[model samples]
Target: MNTQFIKASLFAAGLLLVSTSFAQNKNDLKNWPSGYAPLEVGKRIAAHFIATPHTNFGRPTPPKVITYPESCTWYGALKFAGASRDKELLGQLAKRFEPFFGPEAKLIPVPDHVDYSVFGSVPLQLYIQTKEQKYLDLGKGIADKQWGPPEGPRVVAASHEFYKQGLTWQTRLWIDDMFMITALQNQAYLATGEIKYIDRAAKEMVVYLDSLQKPNGLFYHAPTAPFYWGRGNGWMAAGMAELLGSLPKNHPERARIMKGYQMMMASLLKHQAEDGMWRQLVDDAESWKESSSTGMFTYAMITGVKKGWLDAKTYGPAARKAWIALVGYIDGNDEVKDVCEGTNKNTSRQFYLDRKRLTGDLHGQAPILWSAAALLQ
Candidate 1:
């Protein structure tokens, strides 16, 4: 056979396999294809998390690769722990963050970025699982650094630029910050039972959502970047759910936040491609299917369903489809595929259009865990 014929044959076979796998009714839990268990998916992602050398929960930087993505990995680890009866799995995950379990161990937190607060959850999750006062103190302390009495909240307000007439990331209005800032604040609220922490997170959610959400329900990547970057909207969705989880029903802003989150999901469902993934540029027909955002969006959708924040009849099947499609991206070794690498706000739509893809990136791995945990719930 000629080279072109061989390639075509292989492609055709791949399509057949995927078609058979996804042909079942997604809403029928009994009919979900084999090997799609949420626990199994969580385990696959966790195996990768164990091998990951990016985080050191005990110190400021021992694993040589700590960042918000690493923090996200641990957050998912906590979720995985919750689903499994295995306390050891939870412990194994918490040990990495043990450095923050004590008062003496201090983090040299990254400044002027919501990513810094995102990392606080590493310790905070440990505190939740262990109930060690030190972990709680550590979590709250880390939180204070983000929105604490001294300068944390002020810094974010001053640093985060609100969008006016144009789309931009230079201001804090970017959708990605919605998750980064709220991750820390929500965890802090849980750790300390402090209304202020939750308030800080809740307020930021409104700020970002109001500023970035488009008339179509999706959000722009930033003021200058008008493109609907898939992962950025994923961040907004997940962040909204996280905040709502902590916000009380009586809170005045809960209604607005919930309405916006629901509308966002509606928009996302419309854009979901035939294979169950969203494009890098969410609304663009020509853009390539992206995974990290798919994973984050999966986390958002399943979470909303579990929390009763979304209509199960409408979102349940969509969540299942998203999860199944995302599973296809994992290799035998547990590495997530097609994850867009770390990104920044860009003035041009083409910047996101031409972004590079990576495997085993924490941005993808962490959200997969979060989604799997919720699905199993």
Candidate 2:
């Protein structure tokens, strides 16, 4: 054979080898055991969310930034961290938000421009869990400013309008908003004996559920957005689970909340990938597989089974399968791998899947922590 022909053959073989290696790695990941070490995995991922900082409140600043939408997640991880015999790490995470508070222990920048409800509520929940007055005061300050007078109906800003055109908006209630604000409201009501907070949570939840529910039972992530992002839905599902756990069984809205739960759970089950995970675009498979969303869904489903909201015989197997898929995405050291990094102003299916995954991002770690916590329960 001529020298040129031999060289071409060698190059083709090298390409084939590279492809084969990648295929093998994918298979190895797929074959990983479904059962995960909850305590160990939760700690590792929670550490990542706490360690990465943006501003004084454990929020990342630009050009690398963390949004208020993710605040509940960090707080949730902190809650789990404190509960799981990891006081040292929990204390450290709590301290990160200390700088954001005032001398009276109230959170500064009250009624924040971004998702203020969730941002403030998280610290409050942490305070309640840890008996830290600072978290409580900060949370109360936010609640006072955003929810208005303690005696009247609480009004949430639909968006921050600019120049009368409603430019640079942030006020509209979305499905994910329920997760961000209501849980804290419930905690506040329980702690303070303030009926207003509970009333506020109920009203806003009704608005979100009524306005955002699609004809098919799945709630859209945002009011104006047409596409459904799995993580967004996961946020709503997780919110429902948390709210159900906190709300009294006799509350009038309990049935409505349960109905919403049934709707979302049914829709999510239909969208589960063959490998036991969900894609970034929930109903669309051409999009990339997403671990964060899958983790969130698995977290909600597993928690539901524990709470009797779901029949474990039917959902448990699927949850276990998703958990297995989730572990396959993690690396050998228990860190979350291939998590899609923070997104900005997203509105479409392609926009979500097109996001690049960065290892150890808090967005990924928070859900991973929840996933592990669910398994432990």
Off by over 4 Å in 1: 1-25, 29-31, 55-65, 99-108, 149-157, 160-171
- Model 1 agreement with the true structure over 79-184: per-residue lDDT tens digits: 7787775597887886766654364245435433567657778778778778877777756766776543334343544343432322112236678988887887
TM-score of 1: 0.84
**Pairs of residues at least 3 apart in sequence or in different chains that clash in candidate 2:** 54-59, 54-60, 54-61, 55-59, 107-138, 157-171, 158-171, 158-172, 159-171
Per-candidate Cα lDDT values, in order, are: 0.77, 0.67
RMSD of 2: 10.5
In candidate 2, what residue range of length 10 has the lowest lDDT sum? 160-169
The alpha-carbon deviation from the true structure for residue 146 of candidate 1, after best TM-score superposition, in angstroms, is 1.6
Best by lDDT: 1
Alpha carbon lDDT at 220, candidate 1:
92
Best by TM-score: 1
Per-residue CA lDDT of model 2 for 117-151, tens digit only, reads 56776677677668877677767766655554322
